[model samples]
Target chain A: MADIQLERVRKMFGKVLAVADVSLHIKEGEFMVLLGPSGCGKTTLLRCLAGLERVDGGQVIIGGDDVTDHPPGKRGIGMVFQSYAVFPHMTVFDNIAFGLQMQRVSSAEIQRRVGEGAELLQIQQLLARYPAQLSGGQRQRVAVARAIVMRPRVLLMDEPLSNLDALLRLQMRGELKRLHHEVRSTTVYVTHDQVEALSLGDRIAVMKDGTIVQLDIPDRVYDLPATRFVGSFIGSPPMNFLEGTIRSSNGARALETAGVRLEFHGVPARGRDAVLIGIRPEHIAVERVAVAGGIPAGAIPAAVVVVEPIGPQKLLTVQVGPSTLKVTTPVDFAVDQGQRVWLRFDPSRIRLMDPQTGDAIAS
Target chain B: MTVAEQRLEQTLPPVRRQAVDWLPYVLLLPTVVFLAVFFVYPMLQAFVLSFRSPEGAITLRYFQAMLKDTYFAGALRNSFLLTAIIIPLQVVLALVIALLINTRFQGHPWFLFICAIPLGISDLGAGLIWSSFFTERGYLNLILQNLGLINEPITFLSFERPAWLYGAIVATEVWRATAIVMVILVAGLQLIPKDYFETADVFGASSWRKLRYVTLPLLRPALQTALIIRTILAFQLFATVIVMAGRIVPVLAGEAYFQYGLLRNVNIASAYAVLIMTLSMTITIFYLWLLRTKEEELGRG
Candidate 1:
C-alpha cells in the first residue's frame, strides 16, 4: 500500500560493511523479491526496509515520508521470519490479534480482522490451536496471517518457505503468490531460492556482494542475464562458462576456448583479448549424428562423461577437451556414458561475457 | 495402550518382558536408597524429636516450649520478613542481570563471570566478605570519612542500630544467592529462540511490550525454578545472619542453632528445624502452582 525507497543505504556490522551503498525503489502494491545466495545481503536489505535494522547512511522513504528515524512499529511494516516466529504460548487467534491489540482496536474489529486473516491463510480451523500443535507449513501460514492481519503498509517475508519440506515449500510458494494477489500489499520478499523469486516476484532484484547486480522481470533475467554471475547464478546446474577470447578473422567474429568454437554474427566484434562464452544447459541442444557421418558446422563433437536421469529430462555431462558441459535432453534421447555426440550452440542464444567484469558484453 | 504396543507386548517373550519391567526399579534403587538414608531418615528423626517429650512418650511439649520461647516469635517474624522482601527483590535483580547478560553486551562473558563469581563463594565466605563492608572500621565507613560525608566512622553493625544490621545482613544474603538465581535465569533466557524477539520487533512491539508479551510467558518455568530454590534458602537464613547481624537477629535457622549449640536442647533445635522445613516446603509448592508449565505446551516445541 506504500512505495518504499532506499537512497544509497549503507549498513556496517562492526568493521565489515554488510549492506554497501545501495539504492532501490519498490512501487506501491508490487511484489518485489530480493534474491541471492546465503550471506548475499538480501536479508540485510529486507531488514533495513522493515526498519528492523537502521541504515548507517541514507534515507528510507515509505509512503512519501522518511521512515529511517522511526522505530519498526511506526514504520507500518509486517514481517514473516524464516523461522515462522509464531508465538508458541499464544493460540493462532491470539497471534493474529496481537498487532490489532497493540494498536488499541476494538474487540469486535480485532475479531473481524483475525477471522479474516485466518480465512485468507486458510487457518480458520487452527484458530484455537497452539503453535506446538501445528505443522511447519501451518506455523508459517500462521506467521503470514499474523503479519497481514493488521494490514501493515508494507509486508516483508524472509525465506518463509525455506524451513518447510520440499513438497510443502512448493505448495506454500503458490499459496504465498496467491495471498499477495489477494492482499495486494506492497511486499519485499527475500530468498536465496531462484525458482521462488522467479515464480513469485513481479520483478526480481538479483543481488551479490551487498548490491543489486540485476533487476528485471523473470523472463528477461533468464533469457538475457545482465551479468555472467546472474546468468550462472539463476540456473540449476548453473550456466556453463567456456573461457575464450574473441577472434577476429577477416571481420568474422568467433569465440574460441577449450576445444569449443562459437562463430557469432550481427553483434559487432569488440577487440578483446579475453571473453567468456556463456550458455545454459537447457539452451544447449544435443544433435543426433549418423554413425559414420562427419560432425556438422556450428556443432562441436564431444564425448559424454555421465548421463544423469532427473525426472523426464536427462542431464548429460559431455567432455569438451579438459572442460565439461551439462546438456539437458529428453529421457529417451538414446545417450549413454562415453557416447559421442555433437553439441550445438546457436550463436544468438550464446552470451558474450567480459571475463574481468563478470558481466555480459552489451551488443 | 495403542494396538501396536499391545501387539508388541504379546510378541515379547515372557522372560524378557519380566526383566524389562524390573529394569526401571533396578535403575532407580541407588537414588531411592540414597534419599531414604540421607533425607527421609533425618526428616523422620526431626519429626519424632519435635513431637516427643524427654519422658520418651509421644507429646507436643517441645513444640509448646518452642512456641513459648522468648526468641521464637522474633525468629518467626524475622524469617518471614526476610523471605517476603528477598523473594521479589532477588527475582527482579537476578532477572535483570540475566537479561543484561543475555544481550551479549560487549565483554559479556567477562561481565557474566563477574556477576556469577559469588555463586562460587560459599554462603559463609560471602557473609564474611560482606561483613568487612558493613563493619564500623570497614571500607564503607572509611569511604564515608574520606569523602568528608561524616566526621566519624558509622557503627553499621552496632546493636543500637538494629535497622542497619538488618540492612547489612539482607544485602549480604541477596548478593550471595542472587547469582545462583541469575545463572538459572540466564540458562532459561538462552533456551528461548532469538526468532521470537525478532518477530516481536518486526510486529512493532516496543522493548517493554516484547518483555511482557514474549519473554515473561516463555520464562515461566525458569522463574518458577529460581523462585522455589531462593525461597527455600531464604527460610533457612543462617550463615549470612550469623556473620553480618550475629545474635542481634533471631532468624529460624539461627534459633535452631542457638537451641542446639548454646541451650544444648536437641528437642527444641529439631522443632525449629522442622518448622523451617515445613515453611520452605509450603512456599516451594506455592511457587510451583503459581508458575506451573502445562504439559501440552511442551508437546512438539
Candidate 2:
C-alpha cells in the first residue's frame, strides 16, 4: 500500500473548471472518502488520482514517486466503478484473473490467485457464471474481487455501492471495510451519501464547488464543522441555520432573530454583526410542555408544525418564531401538530457562522 | 394459464383479461400479412418458374442446362470470390472506422458524417463514382501521369487482366458497404458501457487487449447482424459489378439478368435467383452460428 498525495491538482473540461486546486494527502492504508453532491467535482478529483483524467496542473505522488505523467495502467492502481463494470463477456473467474492475464502471469498462478480471491469473496461456486447471471450484490463482489486480485498499491472506488439496494449497500459497505482491513490498501472512495462517508471513511473530505470545505474524522466533521456549508451538508435532517444579528451587551452576547433571542455562552464573536447559528436536529430535545422554572438553558419556545413518526424515532418540525427547526426525539416522546413545545438547544452544539461569507466565526 | 384465468375471473372482470389475451395476436397480424404477401408468395412463384419448360411440363432440364452453361462456373467462382474477399475486407475496414469514431476526437461529427456519406449513395452510383478514378482516361491516370508515376494510362478494368478488374470491383464494394458495417458497429460500441474500458485501463491493458477482451465480444450481436444484411446484399451484386466491370465479370446476379432480359430464358434466370437466395441463406446461417451469443453472455440473462 502507498500513500497518495495530490498537490494542488486542477482539471478543466473545455470552458468548465471541474476540479480547482484540490490538494489532499491520504495516509497509507487509510480509507479516504470524498463526499459531495452531484457536480461537486468529488468524482473528478478521484479520477485525477486514477489517471483516468489528466490534471491541468500539479503533481500526483504515489509512494513518494511522482506519477503525474503516468498512464492509468502504468500507475499500478485498481478501481471499482460505480456501475460495477464487470466484463460481461467473461466468467467471474476470468474477470478476476484479467489483470494477471494482462501482466502475462503464468496459468497456474492465475488459477491459484483467482481461486483464492473467489474463496475470500465466498464466490467460488460462481466462478463459471457470467456477470449477467449474478445479482447486484454478487456483481459488486466480483468487481471487488477483480480489483483486489491485482493487489495494486491503491484502490479507487467511485460510488461503487450506489447501485445496490439499501440492504445490499449496507452489506457491501461492511464487505468493503472488511476487505480493506484484510488487505490494507490505501483506498479513495467517492460518494454523495453522508452516512456511507461517516460509517466507512477513516477521514471524510466534505467537498463543495470543487473545493474541500472540511477534511476531518467523521465525528469531528459532524460535531465541529469548519463552515456553514459543512454544517448544513453533513448531517441527516441537516443542521438548521437561523439568521440573526449578534447583539453584545455588557460582556454578554445574544443572537437576536425575528421573535427569539438566543443567549449564547462560551462563544467568542469576531467582528460579525450578522450571524447564522447552526444546530443539529438530533441535538435538540423537544419538551412536552414549557415548564415555569425547569426550562433548560438556551430554550426556545416553539409551536409544533408537523410530527412525523419515522420508524423507531420521531422527527419534530417545530417553528421557533419565524424559523423552522427540526428536532429528533424518541418514539415514546409524544408531541402533536399545533401543540406548544419548548426546544432545548445544546449550547455546546451551536456553531456560529458568518451570514455574508458563509465562513464559520471562530473565537 | 387456464387455471390462472379461472382464478383471475374470481377477482377481475373477464373483458379486460380477454382484451389483454387478444392484444398479442392483433399486434402480430400486420407482420404475418406483410411476410406472406411479400415473401412466401414470391418464393413459391420462383420455385414454380425454375422447374417449368416451354411446353408447360415440370422438368429439371433448365437446371441441368443452366449448370452446364459456359458462363456458369466462371460466374459462380467470381461471385463467391468477391464475397469471400469483400466481406472480410469490409469487416476489418468497418471495425477500424468504428473504433476511430469511438475515439470521439475533435471534429468527430464531421468525420462520422463523411464516413457515412457512402451509405447515402446506391451501389450502382458508388460503382460509377469509383470508375471515374479507375478508368484509363480518368482522374487516377491523369494524377499518376502528372506525378510521373507512370508513362501511360493503365487498363484497370480490362477483361485481359482479370485480377485488376477484380481489384476494381472489390475496392468499389468495400467503399460502398464498409460504412453500413461501421454504422452498425458504432451503434454496438455505444451500447457498451464506457466503464468497462476504464476498468481495462486500470488493469494495464493496452489498446489491443481492450479491443479483444472488451469490445469484440460485446459487439458480436451487431457484427452478426451487419454480416447477415451485407452478405445477403452482396449475393445480389449485380448493379455495381455491371456498372464497373460489366461482362468482364460474370457474376451470379448478372448471369441471372443476362438469362432473363437478354437470353429470354426465364427458367434459367429463376434457377440462378434460387441459387442466390440459397447461398445468401447459407452464409447468413453460418454467420449467425459463428457469432452466436448465449443468453447469459449478453449481460441481461
Candidate 3:
C-alpha cells in the first residue's frame, strides 16, 4: 500500500555497526526479501523499516513521509517474528484482534477484520485455541493472521518459515506466496535461506557483512551475480573459485591454472597477472574424454573424490591438482571415486574476478 | 539339566548380590527415621492435641472457645487482612521493580545485590531495625522535627491510635518481605524470551499494553508462587508486630505465645497453637487450589 525507501541507513549498537550505509527502495505491493547469512544485518534492516529499530544515520521514508523516528505503532507496519510470538495468554481470536483493539476500533469492525483475516489465512477453526495448543504450522498461520488483521501499509516477516518442518515449510511458503498475491501489500521479508528468498521474493536483496552485495530479481541475482560473495552464497552446491593467472596462448586470452587452461575468445583484454575464475557446478560438464571444439575453452582432467546420489542428479566432488570442485551430473552416470574424468567449462559462464579486490572483471 | 538339578543349582546363596539389593534402603534409613521423629511425630501430636480438652475428654471445646472469643476473632481478622493487602501489593510491586532491574541498566548488579540484602537478614533483626525508627523518640521523628515537618514527636506505637499504629507495623512487615518476592519475580522475568517483547512491538503494542497482555500473563506462575509464599509468611507476622506494636496488636502467633508462657494455661495455649496450625493449613490449601486451577488452564492450552 506504501512505498518504503531507506536512504543511506546505518545502525550502530555502541561500537559495532549492525547495518552499515545501506540504501534500498521497495515499491508498493512488491514482495521484497532481505536474504543473507546470520549477522549480515538483514534483520536489522527489516527492523529499521518496521520502525522497531532506530536508524543512526539515514532516513526511512514511507508513503512519501519521513518516519525514521516514529514508533512501530504509528508507522502502520505489521510483522511476523521467527519464533511465532503469538501472545501466549490470548486465544487466536484475541491475538489477531490486538492491533485493531490498540487502535480503538469498534467491536463490530474489530470482529469483521479478525474474521476476514482468519478466513484469508484459512485458520477460522483455530480461533479459540491458544498459541501453545496449536502445532508449529498452525501457530505460524495464526501469527500471519495476527499481522494481516491490522491491514497495515507494509508487512514484515523475519524468517517465518524457519521454525516449521521441511514439508510444512514448503507448504507455508506456497501459502505465503498466495497470501501476498491476494493482499498485494508492500512486504519486507528477511531470511538466511537463499532458496526461500528466490522462491518468495519479487525482488531479492542479498546482503553480506552489513552491506547489500546485490539486489535484483531472483533469477538475475542467481545467474548474473555482481560479486563473488553473492555468486558463492546464492547457489546450493555453491560456485567454485579457481585461483589462476591470465595469459595469452596462440593470440587468444586464456586463464592458466595448475592442471587446466581456459581460453576466452570474446573476453576483452584485461591487463592483469592474477585473476580468479568462477563457474557454477551445473555449468561444468563431466565427460569420459576431452572432446574437440567444446567451446574451444577451459577443460581439466580431474580425479573424482566423492559421488553423492541425489535421485535425479549426482553431485561429484572432483579434485584437480590441489583444488576441489563440485559438478552436478546425471544420477545414471557411471562415475566412481578415484576415476579420472575430463571436465568441460563453458567459457561464457566462467566469471573472471580480480584476485586482490574480489571484484568481477568485466569481459 | 533336569528341573531338580537346576533348582539345586539356583538354591546356592550369593552374598554380594544380596548386599547390593539391600544397599539403597540402608542408605535411605537415616533420612526416613529423622523425618519420622522430627516432622511426622510433631504434626500428629498437634492434630491429636486439637481434639483434646482440659479434662482429657474427647471434646470440641478448643474449637468452640477460639470461635467464641472476640480476641481470637480479632487476631484471625488481622491475619487475613494483612495477607489480603500484602500479598497482591508485594507481588505487583516486585514484578514492576523486577522489570525495571531487568533492563540493560548500568548499576543493575549493585541494585540486585541491594535487593537481596534483606533476604539474608533474620526476620527478628529486620523487626528490631524497623522498631528503632518507629519508636517515640526514634530517628524518623527526629528527622521530621529537624526538617520542621512536625513540632513534636508522634507516638507511632501508641495503642490509642489503633488504625494508624497497626498500619505502621504492617508497612514494616511489607518492607521486610518484599525482597523475596522481587528475587523470585526477577528470575521469572528473565526466563521470558526477548523475542516475545519484540514481536509485541511489531504488532504495534504500546508499553502498557505489552505488560498487560504479554508480560502479566507469562508472569502468572511466578506471581502465584510469590503470593502464596507471602500469604503464608503474613500469618507468622509475630516478631515485627510485637516489636512495633508490642501488646497492642496481638496476632494469632503472639497470642499463642502469651497464652502459653505468661498465662501458664497449657490447655488454652495448646488450643491456640492448634487453631494457628489449622488457619495456616487452610490458607495454604486455598492458595494451592487457586494455583492448581491456573495450572490446569495452562495444561489445557
Candidate 4:
C-alpha cells in the first residue's frame, strides 16, 4: 500500500476544464472518496490519479514517485470502471489473471493468486464461467477481483456498485468495506451517491465545479457542511435554507429572519448583511398546537402541508412563513395536513451561511 | 420440448394448427420458386451438360477432354494460387484499413470514402483502371522514366514477364475487393464495445496483444464472413485477369470464358464452372470451420 499525492492536477477536454488545478493527498490505506454530483469532475479526478487521463499541468505521485507521464499499466494502480469492463472473451479466471500474466508471473503463482482473489470475492465457482454467464453482481465481483489480484499500490473505483440492484449494491458495499479492511489498499473511490461516500469513505471530499468544496469525516460533512452546495448535496431531503440578515442593535448581534429573532454567541457575523440560516430536517422539533393554547417562546409557528411515510420515519413538509421546511418525525407521530404546529430550531445545529458566496459563515 | 410448449400444442385447435404448419411454407414459396428457376434448375442443367456429351449419352468423355486440355492444370493451379495469396492479402489490408477507419480521426469519413472508391467500380472497370498504370506507356513507366530510373518504358503485361503480369493482376484484385472486406470488418469493429480495449489497456496489453487476444477473438465472425466472401469472389476472377494478363494467366473463370465464348463449347465451360464452384464451396466450408463463432462452440460445450 502506498499514499497518493496529486499536486495541482488539471485536465481539460477541449475548452472545458474537466478537472481544474486541484491538490490532494491521500494517506496510505485510507479509503478516500470523491463525492459530487454528475459532471462535477469527481470521476475526472479519479481518472487523472489512475493515469487513465493525463493531467494537463500537474504531477501525480504514487508511493513517492512521480507518475505523471506513466501509462495506466505503469502507475501501479488498478481501476474498476462503472461498466465493470470484464473481458467478455476470457473466462473469469483469465480476467483475474490478466495483469499477472502481463507481469510475467509464473503459471502456478497466477493460479494461486487468482484462486485467492476469487475466494476473497466469494466467486470461486464462477472462475470457469465467461462474463456472459455471470449476473451483474457477479460481474462486479469479477471486476473487483481482477483489480485486486494485481495488488496495485492504489485501487481506484468509479461507482463500481452503481450498476447493481439496490439490495445487491448494499451487499456489495459491505463486501467492499470488508475487502478494503482485509487488504488495506489505498483507495480512491468516485461516486455521486452520498450514502456510499458517507458509509464507505474514511474521509469524503465533496466536489463541485471541478474543485473540492469540503473534505472531512462523514459526520462533519453531514452536520457541518462548509458550503450550501455541500449541505444541499449531502442529504436526501437536503438542508433547508431560510433567508435572514445579521443585525446589531445596542451592541449585540442577532439573526432576524421569518418574523423571528434568533441569537447565537459565536457567529462571526461582522460585515455580513445578508445571511442564510441552514438547518437539517431532523434538527427541528415539531409540536402540535391545541386550540386556545399559547405558542411556546422561541418557537416558529408553522402548518404541516404534507406527510410522507419513509420507513420508520415520516417526512413532514411544513409551511413556515413564505418558506418551506422538511422535518423527519417518528412514524407514530400522527400529524394531519394544514395542522398548526410550533417548530423550534436547534440553535447549536443552525449554520449561518453567506448568501452571496454560498459558503458557511464560521461560528 | 418443454412441458409448456407441449401443453400449448395440445391446446391449439386442429384447424389453426394446420394453418400454422402451412404458413411458413406459404411464406417460403416465392424464394423457393425463385431459386429453382434462376439457380437450382440452371445448376442442374450445367451439371448434366458437364457430364453428358451432345448426344446425351451421360459418359465421362467431356470430363476426360477437359482434363486433357493443355490449360486445365495451369488454370486449376492459378485459381488456387490466386485465392491462396489474394484472400490473406485482402483480409490483412482490409483489417488495417478497417482499424484505421474505426479510429474515426478528423476527416476519417473522407478517408473511408477515398478507400472505398473502388467498391463502386465494376471488376472490368477496375482492371482497366489499373491496366492504364501498368501498361508499357502507362503512368508508372512514364513516372519512372521522368524520375530517371529507367531509360526505356518497361513491359508489364506482356507474355515475356508472367511474374510481372501476375503481380499486376493480384494488385488490381486486392485493390478492388478489399473495400467490401473492410466494410464488413468496420461493421464488426463497431459491434465490439469499447470497454474491452480500455480493460486491456488497464491490464498492460500492448496494441499487438490487444489485437491478438481481445480484437481477433471477438472479430472471428466478421473475419470468417470476409474470408468466405473474398475467397468465393477470388475463384471467379475473370474480367480482371482477362483485361490485365490476357492469355498469360490461366484462371478457372478465364478458362471457362475461353471455352464458352471463344471455342463455343458449353460442355467444357460447364465443367470449368463446376470445378470453380466445387473449389469455392470447399474453401468456404474450410473457412467456416476454421473460424466458427464462440457461441457455436459454447453451445456444443
Best TM-score among the predictions, by candidate number:
2
lDDT value, residue B91 of candidate 1: 88
Candidate 4 off by > 4 Å? A263-266, B1-65, B104-107, B147-149, B296-301
Give candidate 2 regions above 4 Å deviation.
Answer: A254-264, A290-298, B1-17, B20-38, B52-58, B148-152, B298-301
**Higher-TM-score candidate among 1 and 3?**
3
For B1-301, candidate 2 gives per-residue lDDT tens digits of 6999879878885464333577889999999999999998988777889988778899998789889999999999999999999999999999998999999999988999999999999998998999988898999899999999999899887888888888889999999989999999999999988898888889999899989988899888889999999899888998989988888889999999999999999888999988999999889899888888877776666
Superposition TM-score, candidate 4 onto the true structure: 0.91
Model 2: lDDT to the true structure: 0.88
**Model 2, residue A81: what's the lDDT?**
92
Best by the lDDT measure: 4
lDDT of 2 at B53: 78
Model 1 residue B256 CA deviation in Å:
1.7
Q: Please, what is the TM-score per model?
A: 0.90, 0.93, 0.91, 0.91
Interface RMSD of 1: 2.4
Candidate 2 lands at a TM-score of 0.93
Q: Is candidate 1 or candidate 3 better by DockQ?
A: 3
Candidate 3 lDDT by residue in tens digits, B1-301: 9999889879976556433577889999999999999978876776667677657778777667666766787787777777777777777777777998988599998988887788887778888888788777889899999999999899877888888767777677667888999998898888898878877776667889889888887877787788777776787778887777777777887777777788775556667777767777887787667655332235363
Reference A-B contact fraction recovered by candidate 1: 0.59
lDDT tens digits, residue span A1-363, model 2: 899989999999997988889999999999999999999999999999999999999999999999999999988798999998998778999999999899888999999999988987889999999988999999999998888888889999999999999999999888888888888899999999999999999999999988999999999999888888888788888999887777777977777665456656745644767778788998787776545556555567789899999997999888876688888999988778998877767777888888888888785
What TM-score against the true chain A does chain A of each candidate get? 0.97, 0.95, 0.95, 0.97
Please list all clashing residue pairs in model 1, or write none if there are none: none
Each model's Cα RMSD: 4.5, 3.5, 4.2, 4.5
DockQ, Cα level, model 3: 0.50
List lDDT for all candidates, in order: 0.87, 0.88, 0.83, 0.89
**How do the residues B7-66 of candidate 4 rate in per-residue lDDT, one tens digit apiece?**
998998766333356888999999999999999998898899899866868877777888
